[model samples]
Target: MPETAGPAEGTTAPAFTMPASGGRTVSSTDLAGKPYLLYFYPKADTPGCTKQACGIQEALPALGKTGLTVIGISPDPMKPIEKFAAKYNLTFPLASDEDHKVAEAYGVWVEKSMYGKTYMGMERSSFLVGADGKVAKVWRKVKPEAHAAQVLEAAKGL
Candidate 1:
């Protein structure tokens, strides 16, 4: 995996365009004028990822009231993402970064080790983009449980 770098807080978010589930394209520009939460995960249908996604889903109404839009991104292809969304009844958009370009750009893809095995994959993380397109908060190596609530708290401050 390639090393990732990003602008500091209060700096403009790097521009990106990726294929989203449901055959749509989502771009950084498309998120203008609204605060958005961009979360990166390793794969779809996994326990942690499912918990994180469902947590976000359950908090959608509260997040919406706070004027925040949530988007989940993963290295998985669109087919799995579509199935995951349907299975979880996820209302938010989920982007597929099969090429890992977006994940690399966001600095979420990295070398990971588990059970004494090493491999390259996404390091679950989340970023809060303010209305001005600047990164307001970044949660690296995020924990699944209470993540949505934590993000909601941060979004409230934005």
Candidate 2:
């Protein structure tokens, strides 16, 4: 397997605090003593991001049963984040990392190229932080359609 950025399994997840939709804020401290998922996406309201968010939304009740809290993080501002959540009826917190500090700490911020133009962007990645506060799993370059199911399977064991 190729090496990926961010905390590896068995390591402590990076700390973060940011504004989220629904007039909420999420932080590493707030999630302590509980298993949670921090999923990073490129943008809000985009096709792939939409699919991922919707899939997670559909699985929220099931995920809740597993006691796994899900938070979606993106580099977009809170405005777009709020709109996206409202439009999709996503109740879970969707955070805005406008400065990308959280994304950088998680190692999900990286360089990218599109149409032969190089730029920086958020990587489609996730970190599953177990109740003990260490990362139990890490998924890099995630496939939106399968993300929630994959997360659900892993969370069931936690």
Candidate 3:
């Protein structure tokens, strides 16, 4: 796939609503006027995905101080998302993008290759939306382990 970018900084964030873990629904409308982090990952319960989720969980207190809500989006349905959150004790919303609508809207759904094979999947990417609902920062092909700290630093600006 050709290289592409998500919404640029200062552009309004694309709106979305997805089913989340804990039988909840996360909607951009409800998050309106508040900063939030929307992260897209390839799969739930995998090593990288797990690390990324836990890191955000670890940063929750500080993130909460910044008043930044976080939502993890994946193409997997709610079952695995619920399991992953429970296993890791993640209290944030892990939204299910089973139809890939939100991922595509955010430009995180893309072509991928592994072991000489190619497929379509969610990229490890994140977008921090400011309180005004504009994109504040974008991290593409994110490093799982350091993601939370990076986001926390940026969230302080929101």
After superposition on all C-alphas, the RMSD of every candidate to the true structure, in Å, is 1.8, 1.5, 0.8
Q: Summarize candidate 1's per-residue lDDT along 9-104 as a digit string, tens digits.
A: 788887878887767788889889889989999999999999999999999999999899888999998999999999999878899989988878
lDDT of 2: 0.94
Deviation (Å) of 75 in candidate 3: 0.4
What lDDT tens digits, residue by residue, belong to model 2 across residues 1-158? 12466788999998888999999999999999999999999999999999999999999999999999999999998998999999999999999999999888888899889999989999999999999999999999999999999999999999
TM-score of each: 0.94, 0.97, 0.97
Q: How does residue 47 of candidate 2 score in lDDT?
A: 99
Segments in model 1 whose C-alpha atoms lie over 4 Å from true places: 1-4
lDDT of 3 by residue, 34-112 (tens): 9999999999999999999999999999999999999999999889999999999999999999999888888888989
Worst 10 residues of 2 by lDDT: 1-10
Alpha-carbon lDDT of model 3: 0.93
- Cα miss at 76, model 3 (Å)? 0.5
Best by lDDT: 2
